[model samples]
Target: MVKQKSLTNDNTTKVEFNNSVQTIDKSICDDVNDTVIANGMHLRHTMLTLNSFRFTTQLLRSLLMGFILLTSLNTKQLAQSSNLFNRNTRPSIECLKNDRFYRDPNRPVHKIWTNIECSKYFLCLDGDVFEFKCSEGLLFDVVRQICDFKQNVDNCDITADDAVNFENFDLYTQILFSPNNRNPNGCPIKGTFFVSHQYTNYQFVQKLWNDGHEISVHSVTHRGPEIWWSKNATIEDWFDEMVGQANILNRFANIRMEDIRGMRVPFLRIGWNRQFLMMKEFGFVYDASMVAPFSNPPLWPYTLDFKMPHTCTGQNCPSRSYPGIWEIVINQLEVGDFTCGMIDSCPSQLNGDDVYRMLSHNFKRHYLSNRAPFGLYFHATWFNNNNYLEAFLRFMDDLQKLSDVYFVTQQQVIQWMRRPKITPHLNTFDPWGCKPRQWESPEVACSIPNTCKLRSRVLQQDRYLYTCNECPTQYPWIRNEFGLD
Candidate 1:
């Protein structure tokens, strides 16, 4: 038996075999360099001893074959080590140089990339790179370009066991009632009224908020031809229309800005990426506008970090990614052979039993399958039909009997998406539990609300503003969101 010792330095490895010694330089074997350095010394001694003994040509050939086999094993080990090193290494900030935004300052500044570990992301802005870390238990989603729950990002090292198990058959239901007009007479059964500042009873809106219903923005002017939202609307148009409504709801209805977390595009006319861009910048959590195909397993709400999973059914579906903004798809309801995007658009002629059957049929598709959040999205005008209203109430009553069904607001649904819970544990979920309203001012309550009439330059007529607080000199509209005179 030969005693062997090996020593490694920056550029070479020295090996001593008994009294014989040899040094292997790093440059000779680039692919198998590390392996050679580790075992070359011991193998060198064996070759030398065999050579001195005048070994047969066949024996020497066999010895050479053994050495080749040893090198192959070492090569595999070295390759695995290299891969491990790459995984552990933090990606360089210079990696941003490959992005178009870094190369061209005129390009959009929304460029983002993640480290190999997916624990943090790097944002490129004005040719500079900035690092940001994901929240606890979350990972940087490369597809969506935002920090998200671990289960949503496919490449994450974490297991999906932490997510809510779908086998439990839990169904979350959300009702999104968008009232575009504030008519004093209330929503008409026939047609929508003109958008008004006055008729919306602020006290009633406040009561809804108080009752734990989510107050989401529809639009300040729900103006139409309907094509404007899908075609001519710009990002600024969305900011004014949606954000302006939110401002009015906050000032008059006393709904907190943080609580108003969602928006539905007028007429379900998606403004492509424009509306989503505004939603992301303005802290809105989700958009319940885009329509999905009427499929058996309906589409679930998903983040805009990657391309949309379904085809763009409505006009101008978002083509760009708007990370962190959730898209609650309006999975179409089947009525006979046709499908309607909004539940209200479904045949209103149906009897009470028929209405119940239609809703139950569509709902079971989600309930029996992936258990995606089922939505009942409609305008308040839909309730004007007595049969439709009665059947909807009956449907709600039936759903309440299920131990696993929960009727939640859109904001609450988004919260559940972030941290999902199994049916058994959902009872303790904090987001669903109602708490007392946190009013910014004590004047949020109004025993006698003020009705202010102000001249509007845009409308060229007097506009009404009903509020619990002091009325502004001018009624709030598009650019004049705060109702400043």
Candidate 2:
């Protein structure tokens, strides 16, 4: 097995090694299978999807400690069968890994002591709302109740199946929806925010994206792929479907590159063609177009051969939901993007209980494995599920419980997937753009608009993104360091 180590000097480089890390070296995988069978940790029906892992230092340290302690305990009482049973089958557990108490920014870091005696870390299926919890753990649900029994946004109902629930032991997760598209003046908008009504929408997304919650890019109008990707479509259709989106996004979010970070194929077109690779050529980091193993369709990402972020010519990492990018030969689990369907893409038949069950399954899969990224993919239109926004809020509360895991933006993870084999900091600055000159006199490289858009976050800043006359629906970049972008 090959392993990578992150070393920092003048640069950060990932060096591959032979058996340097957690060793499970058997090309045939027969040894691992045998060991699993012998140990009785065999696969169960519920053991399904897996999230991709970064193998962080914490994980490595925990594994090392567990190994060292197991070795010491075993050798300390060698020769006695009773001792072996006592050591390996202790009635207790090992100390937690890199576990830190969550604290408020204004407060002190208080120690959160825990003795996991009866701590059952399981995904709980409430009658209607589901959440993650460890029995006897703190109750950490209801960060903000966005929905009520009426399924209203901020509706104050709290009726029979209205409230979302999660035990205190879990963490709050971030959720962001790549917006849909629109046709303006009979032209498809491109490179802009799809939903262009309110600044609050953009502000919310900006905050979540900054917080490491994912904020992916959907199509400009979210036109079904038939119109967007079809070969039979005319130039107008292409523009309306493709460039239109780019232009709109450019106007809204103002993303300069124009290519969106991720997208779900309209009508699941790519699921049949498996052409998501085509998107990479345009600079998309990844696509959330597929489903996962526990998904309604139930496909395994391990079967896909993809390992990195990709363009049209290359393959990409398999999502936990829909599968097949990974080499069908090699197995690496990928977490798929779950979604909220305010529109018709997926059926909205799941009761609150059903939805909660699905989410519980998502977490349970991660808990069973070494833990990886799980994308709670959805659409802003999902807010339509109920008249009020309580359901979505409830969903958010439940999803946030996996604090130990990272909820990254589509771009961040994709950039990581594009993780270079050479080394980081090679350029010191990104190779894509001009270097900033704070001390040097600022030059007016481009023309500013005569009238800036009302949504410009940069007005408070140095007035950087907004032109005097131009108003981008959203900036080319995400909110700059100060939300000005």
Candidate 3:
């Protein structure tokens, strides 16, 4: 929303500007150091929140595309003249201020947030997301959590105030890139997107979709049962929420709506079979409303799914009650509704920050592990114009930086699940080498040939190990890749 002027002159060429994007500061780049550093701390977290994702700046041109070398800033925003031995550490206080991502060496500031890669950082440009060049703050946040640090800010040789800046000693988890680089066409990537979904940033949604992020419908109206979810929810509500959501989403970017491909229950609340019925009506490829009893998502400490393992035998697997719908249960393995708090009917009215931490933990963990889609249950009210919403979005923006986790709709996951449901041939090293938990087949579908359905059941392995009979091959899928085999 902020505006800035393009300081680049007529002679400024992309080649020339690209050459100068590496420097952190110049004489003119002053004014907002603290803001830049703090922001950078948050931005750094975004870049490295989830270690499972590996971001590559591949130009997805029609033909054989050339690679674009994206430049990010050094983790240390400020040049520590005295703290040369700090090594990879930067002052938290200063680094948290006016730091930039994908910032130009010549120009060191992000005028606005946007999806545009930092071709050149000029004091004049503008956008929302600065750039995903590197991850510094990410290391700080994740490491601080799992690791134990006791530097004693003031108690040490340095004063308490010095601890915020001179502190070092880090790293809890590091990124491990998967071997698969030839991702599918619908894979996740950063780009400007535009879409037309209900009460959503249609343009933002569309941009995210076009830019390779998963675009989906949150709800038809994004309202509760009385207004949009009720048995008597009206055509108007449908127009405002359901149809409107689809229309906006369909119009999202220039992409065809036929591949928009995802949906979730508006309020994470659905009637008996209402969600399934709606998934059909909405033409979604998958529905993520199936948060059954167990879900082995890759993330933890917030939402964890621990269920008793079952068995998936020959034809007697999990039964499928509906067509093209997978029941995605939010397994609160770390902590969820039962512990911290579940965003129920009045989630939007909630006034707690713990909700975000809980949600973010799952997202970060899943991203790091390249695990399955994280089922985030939130109500429309969660995005209301309130402090809660502001904090939530900020937290989300940081989460986005953590990893290239696909922000898919339930439909998309369902579609992926529907694609040739083959179990990974069990290998000796496959988690204690135990057989996959079997699904419960329906009485009617017994030995029915092609119609053999897979029922929902989580067969537990040993202590801390479990997989779904329905999706055993890839017990946890990330970036469309499964680890089951």
Identify the candidate with maximal lDDT: 1
Those runs of model 2 whose alpha carbons end farther than 4 Å from true positions after fitting are 1-217, 224-240, 258-260, 271-280, 292-349, 370-372, 385-395, 398-403, 415-485
What's the candidate order when arranged by decreasing TM-score?
1, 2, 3
Error of 3 at 139 (Å): 46
**Per-residue lDDT of 262-324 in model 2, one digit per residue for the tens?**
444443334322233344334444455443323332222232333433222222322433333
Give per-residue CA lDDT, model 1, range 346-370, as digits (tens). Answer: 8767888898999998889889998
Query: TM per model?
Result: 0.58, 0.34, 0.32
Task: Kindly give the stretch of ten consecutive residues in candidate 1 with the minimal lDDT sum.
Answer: 160-169
Candidate with more favorable, higher lDDT: 1 or 3: 1
**Which candidate comes out best when scored by TM-score?**
1
